[model samples]
Target: MRVRIKGDVLCTLLLVISLSTLLYSLLRPTAKQDIAPVKNTKRLKNPPRTAASKKYYDSKVTGKVKLLSEDHHADVDSEDVKPTVPPVKTQSPFDFQQYLSSKDHRNFSLLINQPNKCTKPSGESFLLIAVKSIVEDFDRRESVRKTWGKEGLVNGVRVRRVFLLGIPKNKTTVSLWESLMQQESHYYKDILLWDFLDTFFNLTLKEIHFLSWAEMFCNDVKFIFKGDADVFVNVENLIHFLQNQNASEDLFVGDIINHAKPIRSKKSKYYIPETMYGLGIYPAYAGGGGFLMSGVTMTKLAEACKEVELFPIDDVFLGMCLQRINLKPVLHEGFKTFGITRPSAAPHLQTFDPCFYKDLMVVHSLKAAEIWLMWNLLHSQQPPCSQKQRIKKPFHWKKKKTKQAINAVTRLQVN
Candidate 1:
């Protein structure tokens, strides 16, 4: 009975011990569970201490959030953090040198040429005057044709006049201009048309092309006068000047400028950058407004043009050509490129005088009205004004009237 009682006590003791151990385990918390809640609460209460810390926190949290919210806005803040894009590059408009130096532009084919316009096998033509004109300048062309450009004899030398023209810019205008040119050619047989653009910069092209034409057709011509359409040429005085010159000697005559510098200002219409010409001083060359060259000099200049690179400025480029051939231009006092400055006298007091322009070979910048008036005045047989003060009066005369008077005088003398 005592042994059975002891066994019951032992079993009771073992059951109490097992129950205590089970209670302890149920009351104690695990390490991960205890720290997880504390960490989340701390993060919610305190902001990040620095940009680096904030970035780290945002990277960790936003990575998961981005993946979950991709359908709605994955890249909402991404653009703000992205790097800036670079700007596009642009081309320069003043790079004319590169355009000029291009190999494709080295040679140009003639669009229109008059091979037989000035040709004379027996060499009867004493002077061949080439007037650089545009296709659309019909009024100016007509004025020239009627005034100084009339085809006839000047001082007993047979003179021929031809107008130089180039292609128009507009395609529609091209056909119209071409048709008109064809009719003009048929009627006057004086228009020399070419295929290049007739621009201020392309005046050198006109010069070179005319030189080529002269070589082909007018080889035997004694003198060649290259002038602008607006100029008044005294063919009589020009012939008289040529009469004194040796026909075999090369002659290049005009109002010459020496040591002319290339215009560097970008704002100027005559701007020429160093890329076109690098020289500090330009050799002497005649103003392009009007110039005179003998047949031999024209041949030499034409040959020189072939070897020298083309310059945009016609006068400067001609100077370069002359430099290449070791030739120089003769300066004439009477070749007025700038229009004759009017004296400070009353218009009524200023009577038109024919003697004033009788000695001048070329007078530039004349209008059609002035040219006509001058032509009429020169033809009229009025006695010379005997005003003693007239000799002392500033030699001021209207351009058109002066040209007309000079041309009329030329006609009278030649007849």
Candidate 2:
């Protein structure tokens, strides 16, 4: 009985040892797989720079992609989509010098392969260059011209050149360009052009102004006014302002916005970029409110322009160029840059009158009729009866004060 029991115990121990050995062998592989040793591997080989090779690896993958399309393509089509021929990238054709010499200097030359079809104007020549855009309405243009045009010779002052530029339009903006050119072409002979060609090449409009001014100079233009078309420049007043103010190379006369910073807002038409004009004090330059630049100043400006890079914005760019050469922009009090509300200062004689033409230099953003009226007021042989007013005030201060003084003297004498 004891022998049989011992044999039974040995058999049980052998069976348990065999089972444990089998379990260890199965679990050992799983443990090894779970905790496998890491190894560093070499990177894949790179393809060549050519487009064909680039398709294989660089720009595109020419290899087949497994598709599970509901409507499977043919086996051949599914194989791979390869390029027939590779495209090539080339250099741009922009000649800076030739572009500068072109009659129309505004707009980018790099993008547009074609030249301006318009001819270089000649005979009975005067160049009136408008920096901004001309409005579509011919009436507006004619109205301004009638007022500003030289009446034979206004008090011995001559209107030599008149060029109007509409806002900038590029090749992409062809429609705008066509319309603008058409509007001016009908009436104006010497239509001057300007664009991003200077700015793209990093050249200033001052250079264009310089070149145009040089071409015309004293022979054509007696006084050159550089301003926005939107501005209603009292041409007669502007001429007087230039002549009476002793216009010279060092002198620049205009309505000045005095601040380190221009009024910039997203909604405002005067929105300037932070990149172009960073936050800081800006030196006061003449506002776009019709600045009267002397022929002498134009020459100086033209000469100064050769050295400076083109800045995008005209007025500030002009200011910067002037600042570089130590030319200061003179603020004319007669110039009403930002228009007045009737509530502001009453129109004093010699000071600007919101009512009558009390030495009004330039009024900007005027409608056609308003421009006509202003012009008529300035030129008409008849004196205007009374100043137009939104609100009529009693007691004319200038006359009433004189009468009061006389009355005081009489009363004192009687007493």
Candidate 1 residue 63 C-alpha distance from true site, Å: 55
lDDT of each: 0.74, 0.51
- Tens digit per residue, CA lDDT, model 2, 1-415: 9999999999999999999999999999988655532211111122124443333343332223222222332442421322212344432233334534662443332221112211232332222333333434456656656666433345554354444443343455355765556556555543544444323233344335434434443334435665544556665566666566544344577787667575455433344546545767676777765676655667666656555545544666677767777778788776666764343244433223334453566667767777777667656665443444533553254434588889999999999
lDDT of 1: 0.74
The C-alpha stretches of model 1 lying farther than 4 A from their native spots are: 1-98, 101-107, 120-123, 171-175, 342-353, 383-415
Q: What is candidate 1's CA lDDT for residue 184?
A: 86
lDDT of 1 by residue, 1-415 (tens): 9999999999999999999998878766676567756765664466434554445445532112222233333443543223221332433324575547652353457555556665533337788889899888888888888887777766677888788887876667556777777888878888887777777777778888888878877888888999888887777788888999987898999999998888787645677777667888888888888998889998998889899887777898899899999987899988987766556554544323565566678888888777777766555576244345645655355544578888999999999
Cα RMSD of all models vs. native, in order, equals: 21.1, 16.7
Position 265, candidate 2: lDDT: 51
Q: List the residue pairs that clash in candidate 1.
A: 370-400, 370-401, 371-400, 374-401, 374-404, 374-405, 375-404
